[model samples]
Target: MSFEFVGKFLPYFNDGLIITLMISACVVLIGTLLGTLIALAKLSKIHVLRWLANIYIEIFRGTPMLVQIMIGFQLLGKIPLPEFQLGILTEDLSRLVPGIIVLSMNSGAYVAEIVRGGINAVPKGQTEAAYSLGIRPTATMFKVILPQAIRNILPALGNEFVTIIKDSSLLATIGVMELYNGAQTTSSTTYQSLSPWLLVAVYYFVVTFITSRLINLLEKKLGKGYTK
Candidate 1:
């Protein structure tokens, strides 16, 4: 409400923003890579691989991400594996690993569907032509199919990026100290819930708005290449 309150809460929220961005960046990279593999598997000639990929996508996509985060956090920490015993994955930083995994798995499910659709949208003639020219199946997929599929799917992936940015706020529920968590903490300590929450909303708006605009520009740029 007051400018003083706004100024006071900005610092904490800003720190939270950094964490949110870090998580989002990792999620996008991991999700996109895993999702592409899942999509390819779903399209495979082999039945078993296709079944397994479908099961993964359906389970993750069908469930709530919040539940997945909680379960993953608990399950990953209790694996009793070598990595768990290693210094690299102490209990203090363990939660973050699961958080990233949960986010990646959730995002991967959606991305898999997007990729599958994009690949399907590519013309069959393109693959046939590539084959006629003596291109290997793998080469045809990587060079010709995926390239165009990426173009078609870029906008959708941008939308997913934006969605993940906002969704990162949900990590606050697990004490990840993202924007929402920071605001919650500040509100509790300062008893200025109204101002802290409003400010967090503004921060979300600004980041998502800028990202959406950038995505629009990228779409136009990619579209130009396709049209030509």
Candidate 2:
């Protein structure tokens, strides 16, 4: 409601926005990579690998992210890490590192399921054909199966990216200075609680909305060749 107040703190929000995007980008890349490996492990013939992957996925997916962030912060904070600056962002590796790690781990669990489902959706004959040509199982999975599986799961992966953007707010609890923390700081300083939050909500909506539209466009472009 207070446009003037919101305008005054826009730069602070922008800074927080940068951190949020950075965290989400790291989580998406790391989570997807970790998830894909977990998915492959889950689909492996090795019983020990399947069991370990199942346990990892279950533990991360079953727990709350906030708790994970808090615990990870405490545990990882013990390790000594040097702080550095990245332009507008001051890298507090103690908090930022744990926040990104916990988020990536949590995200990896859900992405693992998405990837597993995508792999399952692929036709079995594809693998059979690859194997018939004397392709090793690993080669068949990497070369023949994962590409198709990734295509099938693009929308789901996009959703995961959006989710990470929103969920990055949790990092604020441990003082990582993300968007929500910026709002909180503004509210504490300006003595207007609702306006800062409202403005932050708009910021979140704009980012997520634009991201969703971009993902949709990418999906369409990717699907064009398959369309009749």
Candidate 3:
């Protein structure tokens, strides 16, 4: 039999796309914040904090995100156990929240290292110079160290966004209807393999490519002033 996608199903894919973008945006935002903190902790002077940060980074960065998602949901199930109702942990939480949590946690680990390296790469003289001006440690970090580090980390952070976008596909396992899942449902109904997925791939490529181009433009702008 011939295949076709009805306009009604169009909404499914569209809504799926929206959910995908939403999840990606949330993951990126949460990931960046947590990642920045992790990066700072990794660079901390205290041994225990640095060691724990390193382990967190290693475990997440070293393992696949899919594994993290699975383990997170499972652990969520066992959390607080029967002893504590801990109604805070519910089944619905496993469906979408866990995806976000896992994505952010995993992405944060990698982004942390990137951020740490970026901060370290900033000249030590800059930090000392800021301190010489009587700037507080926090002020120096934000105004001097972090500003320069962000300039260096922009490209890598952009890559992290792209990775989060792609990793969202794993959400389907938990009933999150993202692009890949949308395409799968459509293909199942239409019985046509490549056409549905080809369109899906194009959508992904277009979104990622446009974002990448923007990143390049920002990189150039930032690099120019820094080079001066």
Model 3: pairs clashing at backbone N, Cα or C within 3 Å: none
Say which candidate scores most in TM-score. 2
Q: Could you tell me which 10 consecutive residues in candidate 3 have the lowest summed lDDT? A: 82-91
Give candidate 1's error at residue 182 in angstroms: 1.1
Estimate, for each residue in 107-203, the C-alpha lDDT of model 2 and write its tens digit: 9999999999999999999999999999999899899998888779999999999999999999988888778988998899988868899989999
Candidate 2: clashing pairs of residues = none
Which candidate would rank higher by lDDT, 1 or 3? Answer: 1
TM-score versus the correct structure, for each prediction: 0.91, 0.94, 0.88
Q: Which consecutive 10 residues in model 1 have the weakest lDDT in total?
A: 83-92
Candidate 2, superposed: residue stretches over 4 Å from native:
84-91
Q: Which ranges in model 1 have alpha carbons more than 4 Å from their true place?
A: 78-92
The lDDT of each candidate is 0.84, 0.89, 0.80
For model 3, residues 1-228, the per-residue Cα lDDT tens digits are 222674545665666677778889999999999999988888888899899998998899789778888888776644442221112112234467777888899989988988998999999999999999999988998888998998889999999898788789898786666777878888887787777787778778887898899999989888884661
Candidates ranked by lDDT: 2, 1, 3
Q: What is the lDDT of residue 43 in candidate 3?
A: 83
List, residue by residue over 1-228, the lDDT tens digit for candidate 1.
Answer: 544655666667777787778889999999999999999999999999999999999999899989998999788855543322221112234566778889999999999999999999998999999999999999999999998898889989999999999998877666666778778877887887588888888999999999989988988887884751
